[model samples]
Target: EAAKVRLADGQGREIACDGVLLTGQFTPESSLGRQSHLQLDSGSDGPKIDQYGRCSDPAYFAAGNLLRPIETAGWSYREGRRIGSLMALALCNQLPAPHDALTLKYAAPIKLGVPGRLVRGELAGLQHIQLRVSRAVSGTLRVRAQGLDLWSRPVSALPERRLLIPLKELQLPEHLDQLDICID
Candidate 1:
């Protein structure tokens, strides 16, 4: 089982594969907003939006992967809900509250590879890799892995006095040694 990939004229080509999974990249499709004179912030690969889902233009707003590039669908839905609320409040002429983005702290997906022999270990035979996450500080999220401790850390610190957890990531740590293992 072998696969070959080729690129020509900035296009991709694939050949000789028993099974091929084609996935499309997340592309910002703000053409409608652009046509409506909305200012889109293309700072990164995806469209840029404020914490409140407000685009560069006040009249326009965005959400989901189109607004910001995120790997998880859970985050996208949460963003949509937050943006929807902001839009509704704005249209109602009521002083819309500020939007505070939530931090998504989850373990990275496990990678699958060919099976290999385990040499001299407490547990023998096939072994699995796991990710561990814990709370180091009161408001900080730390991620750790097997044989590693706290490689990545994200601060859930918010600027506003009010606490709004757009998603579960904003929730306080459950335990001292709790590892959040999210498959896909």
Candidate 2:
């Protein structure tokens, strides 16, 4: 016969609540990507892709919440439309295959970074790189390649919200195996 529940915080604070409802633990469903043998991004637990959304197989492309997870409907819709157009171009042989691409490397508390790979020549249309953090953080987010600072900005982010890094001013080196995204 419990009328209420008491929750204790790490800082020694306690709160009484009628109930606790926990949510937002959604993970992208990637069984199909697995069965299809597409390269998987451990960060998003989805198919790894380039800025244009081309997956490991040149014939396969993925987009939207399927690549991330549980974004707003509007975001998913826009992403679908954008990637759909790219798919059409690919079908017509107008889209260039991913080359000169750099793999993205990030550590906690960065939960994920969209466009798991970045293509140098094909980056013109990509406006921003979306990111999600595993927890709350406030610091300067930086992107580095070939020991050079490609981009940096101060950010305050929470787990439930998506963060965007604009690519308009970003520049990467011609010869780099990976790009590092970090917060410091």
Candidate 3:
């Protein structure tokens, strides 16, 4: 609804405004997944899915909506298509075994990360690391590996909003394999 908002006082005149913004709390419906013994994402209140949407229970697979309730229809469709294709490949034993895949854990302020995990061998093509901030903050977000700074960026984060860290140019040293993102 785009309309003038009435002033708080008992006045007839409406306040001039471009538009009205309305919002409500959005709960990620993941209790069923959790009840079924799936790993719940600490950051998103959703299932912790792998790069291919596989849940902890090998018999189960979740993509798109079941993974992230706030996703758009187009994104959900893409996830389904991509994960379905990958599942088909796995059924035929065409997919290669993951080599030294590790989870992307975080410290305080960062609740969760998309791709919850990544293959160490896949770092060369790493593109994005998305997370939900615990609260609004204005500071430098840093990714540290083995207590050494690996990457950093200025961030203005809002709760529940996707905070993306682009990693297209990341160059990891051979000795340091694990990384953690924290607000500094």
Candidate 4:
């Protein structure tokens, strides 16, 4: 038999409890991605993908919260629609392959960045870069590439909240090996 759990408030007063319910350490279901040998991001524990949602295997594609878990259903639906269209284009040979894509990395408080990489010519179509933080922070979020500051903005971020950095405002160089995002 399991030991009975006691309930209590901040006042140190005990409250009666018949049973305890536990839930909510949700994670992405990525067993398939793993079995397929897809590269996974250490931070998100999801498949690494490019802007078009293409995984390391050109034949495979991933989208929605599968790329980064725990987004609103609506956000997932929207992402599905967008990436679905790209997938369709790919099937029709209408989508161009990414030849100049660069990886986007993060450190410390930053949990993950969606799309995982930056695709050269596709930057014009990218509206924003979605960022998830590992903890609550209040500071300037900065993006740098090749020792050059690309973008920075003051932000107060919580682990549960998603941050958006407008891509249009950033003047990223024509060629970059990697882009880094962090709170400074």
Count the clashes in each prediction.
0, 0, 0, 0
lDDT of 2 at 121: 71
After superposition, candidate 1 runs with Cα above 4 Å error: 1-26, 45-48, 96-184
Q: Whole-model Cα lDDT per candidate?
A: 0.38, 0.81, 0.67, 0.78
RMSD values, in order shown: 16.7, 5.0, 4.8, 4.7
> In model 2, which regions exceed 4 Å deviation?
1-22
Q: What lDDT tens digits, residue by residue, belong to model 2 across residues 54-129?
A: 9987789888777887788898888888888888888887776577678999878899998898877743544678
| Weakest ten-residue segment in model 3 by summed lDDT | 118-127
Best lDDT among the predictions, by candidate number: 2
Model 3: per-residue lDDT, tens digit, 48-115? 75565566654566676676557667866876887788677667755444444456677768766766
Question: What does the lDDT read for residue 75 in candidate 1?
Answer: 54
> Please, what is the TM-score per model?
0.39, 0.84, 0.69, 0.83
Ranking by TM-score: 2, 4, 3, 1
lDDT at 74, model 1: 76
lDDT of candidate 4 at residue 107, scale 0 to 100: 78
Error of 3 at 106 (Å): 2.3
